[model samples]
Structure formats: C-alpha cells, structure tokens
Target: MSDFNSSVNLTMTINGVPRVIACNPADMLCDVLRSAGYTEVKKGCDTGNCGVCTVWLDGVPVPSCSVFAGRAEGREITTVRGVEKEATEFAQFLVAQGADQCGYCTPGFTMMVLALKRELKSPTETEIRHYLSGNLCRCSGYEGHLRAIIKYLEASHE
Candidate 1:
C-alpha cells in the first residue's frame, strides 16, 4: 500500500486571512505563495542568495525560497502586500530620494525594511546596511535605498 502522506494540507494565516493549501514535501514556500496569489513575493535567485522572495514568517523575516511550504502550515505569513500600509511611507521616501530604480527589488527591500522597522525604533547606518545585505539590487546601486532607510528611521523617531 502506498502512503498518502506525501503531500500535506497547510492551514496558515496569510495577510491576516486564514488560508488553506496543499503542498508537496519538497515545495518551497515561495512557489506555494505565488500559487496562492501573493505575487509580491518575488522569485529572485531561488537559492536564497537574493532576498526578493523575503517574507515574514510569524513576524520574522525569512527567505521564502529557503523554507518549505509545510513549515508554514500553522504560522502567519506576511508578504510585502501584507505590510504595504506600514511600508508606504518608506517606499515613498525611496522613490522621492531616487532610490527606487528599476523597481524589481523594491518589494523585497520594502518587506525586509518593514520588518526591521517593527523590530527597531532606530537603526544606525551600519545596522541598516547589515540588515539589508541579503537583498541585492543592481539598478539603484543601493545609494538611494540606504538614504531612504536612514530617513525613514529618523522620521519614525519624531
């Protein structure tokens, strides 16, 4: 007799909504999220090198590519869209400061920064850079990104 446990049913909260999905043992969270309509979770360098697929797993920032969908079965998943309201001001700052070039990696950067904002009341330049090292950008060259993050950090203190 064949085992029926190869694929598992996942019941997780996504963007504050209860979500139910089925995933195979080897399916990555990124693939499952995209399948479930969370396109904001980008698929960049699916080997976990790029942070484009970054998402919040129970309030912690993690690369969806490195995580299996089964791992999120009962946790809360927050994509960039989930935190759009919280990251809007920071996103605008990046745009106004000319930091959002090309815009491909902006969602990932925004998501990661939004999580950082939740964890830190204020972050130093070095800390910002360190925290953002995972997400790679080629168009903006990270100049505008760094500046915008600094400005966001400063503004939140006021």
Candidate 2:
C-alpha cells in the first residue's frame, strides 16, 4: 500500500471480545474504537487533557485519544462497557451520592477508579484523589466521588 493510503489491520481484544479493525496508521485509538462501535469510550478533549476517553489498555488505564490504533494491536482494550458490573456499581454509587451530576465525565472517572481498585487493596482518600487527578468533573465537586470510592472499598472488604 502507498504511504498515503496505508491502512493497518489491527487485532485487539476489546471488552473481552477480540476485534479486528483496519484503519490509517495514524488514527488514534479513540477514533478507531468508537468507529468499531465502542461508543462508551467517550471522546472529550481529544488532546488527552480530559480523561473522558480513558480505557484500559492491557489492564492499565490510558487515554485512548493519545494512543495510536496501530499500537493497540495484540493488546487487551477494556472500555467502560467491559466492566459493566463495576461501572454500574460506580454509577449507582455516584447517583446515590449525587456525584453523577452532568454524567458526561462519569465514565472516565469510573474507569480510573476501577483501575485504582483493581491495583490497590484499600487505597486512602488521598491516594484515590491523586490517582484520579487526570479526570475532570466541572459539575459536581469531588466530595461525592471520594465518598463513593471509600464506600466501595469498604464494601469490597466486607
């Protein structure tokens, strides 16, 4: 294929299902994933400043927009939909705590929190806040999210 029309074929596992996608080598993972139907991977600040396009790449939380689709080949990609159970729980917690106001940034926040939970046993409030620093929530303040994370952590231990 000519350089201008070069399309790379990528085989990556998304949300527990293996998917193959063909796209330009320079296409960002966020665009590629959304095109492939994983709309849950929201596209906010495409510059990676807003963590709305967060996804778990090989079990590590990363901003999809900053990653190239070609780099994701042979990797495991987990969008918010992949962790339905956890995301749902986080959503419920957010609702209960009134943390889900605006809701646009919730998915990214949830994904980061889920990754934190998976990596840490019982993270402190400070740790949680520090870990989720990349995500921005302009509507509701972070108190509710902090409460929800603490509650979730407590419940997990019970």
Candidate 3:
C-alpha cells in the first residue's frame, strides 16, 4: 500500500537531542540510527533474538533491529551513549570482573543492565539473570558478567 522507494522523515529525540532523519518506511530503527551516526546501536541478530541492537524507546529498552524506523517518529530513543556517565561507571565494574571482552555485546548488555538498575532497584541474582536472558554473549561464559553486575549493583547502592 506504500511506496518502498520513498523516504520518510522521522523526528526522534536521540540522546536528549532532537534529530530529524530520513529513512525508508521499511527501514529498521537499528539501521536508521546507525546511518544517522548512532553506531552504538549495533546490529546482531536482526531477527530480534539477539539483544545487540537494544535501545530505550521512550525509556523502555527494546530491540531496535526489530522495530520499524517510522515507529520512532516523535519519540525519544536512548542509545548506550545516552547514558554515558552511568555506562562508564558500569564499564569499570565490567572490566574489573573481566566481562568486557570482545565488546560486541557490551553496548546492549550495558543498556539492559542499566535498565535493570532503574527498574529493579535491588534485584536478586535470579532476577538479574532473568532480566538479562535476552542478551547472549559468545565469550566470557556469563559468569564474569554476573559478577560484574553484582559488583556494580552493590556499588550503586552505596
């Protein structure tokens, strides 16, 4: 019912700054954001199985690769870069726990962890595991990630 070749202009608040980007109606938000210079939104399993392209759509984390770009019009989208300060602090914990290897999954993992912190406040280990189940890591075996999350959460509450 719509022209596939046509580009649509979408205005989204990215990292607290309003940006207008042109993308095809069928373009995925991950592709659009990356093209618009938000490379922090990585592209992994474009089918949404992998959480590599997670971004906060209006303060809720969702897989950008599974979302249509046009759906983000006039909405606020927060990538990992949007929470640089908190992410940086959390990254320290990640490194100390040896969870920052490869880094391909770090951005999305960070977004999910940050969301967990905000939403859960003080989550149990099982809750943390459940919350992060969508994110998969090929390296580190996730033990390091779990340690890093526990450490980060402990530090945050102090």
Candidate with best TM-score: 3
Q: Report the lDDT of model 1 for residue 56.
A: 89
Q: Among these predicted structures, which one has the highest lDDT?
A: 3
- Which stretch of 10 consecutive residues in model 1 shows the poorest summed lDDT? 1-10
- Give residue 114's lDDT in candidate 1 (0 to 100): 86
Candidate 1 residue 93 Cα shift, in angstroms, is 0.2
User: Least lDDT summed over 10 consecutive residues: which range in candidate 3?
Assistant: 20-29
Regions of candidate 2 where Cα sits further than 4 Å from its true position: 1-5
lDDT of 2 by residue, 1-158 (tens): 45746887889899888888999858899999889888888888899998989999999999999998888989999999999998997788778777878788877888998998889888877888899999988797789988988888788778
- In order, what lDDT does every prediction score? 0.85, 0.87, 0.92
Q: Would you estimate the TM-scores of all the predictions?
A: 0.93, 0.94, 0.97
Better of 1 and 2 by lDDT: 2
lDDT at position 53, candidate 2: 92
What lDDT tens digits, residue by residue, belong to model 1 across residues 22-78? 777468999999987888788989999989988989989899999988789889999
Model 1 spans > 4 angstroms off: 1-5
lDDT for predicted candidate 2 compared with the true structure: 0.87
Compose the digit string of candidate 3's lDDT tens values, residues 1-158. Answer: 89988998888899999999988958999999999999988988899987999999999999999999989999999999999999999999999988888999889989999999999978999999999999998887999999999999999999
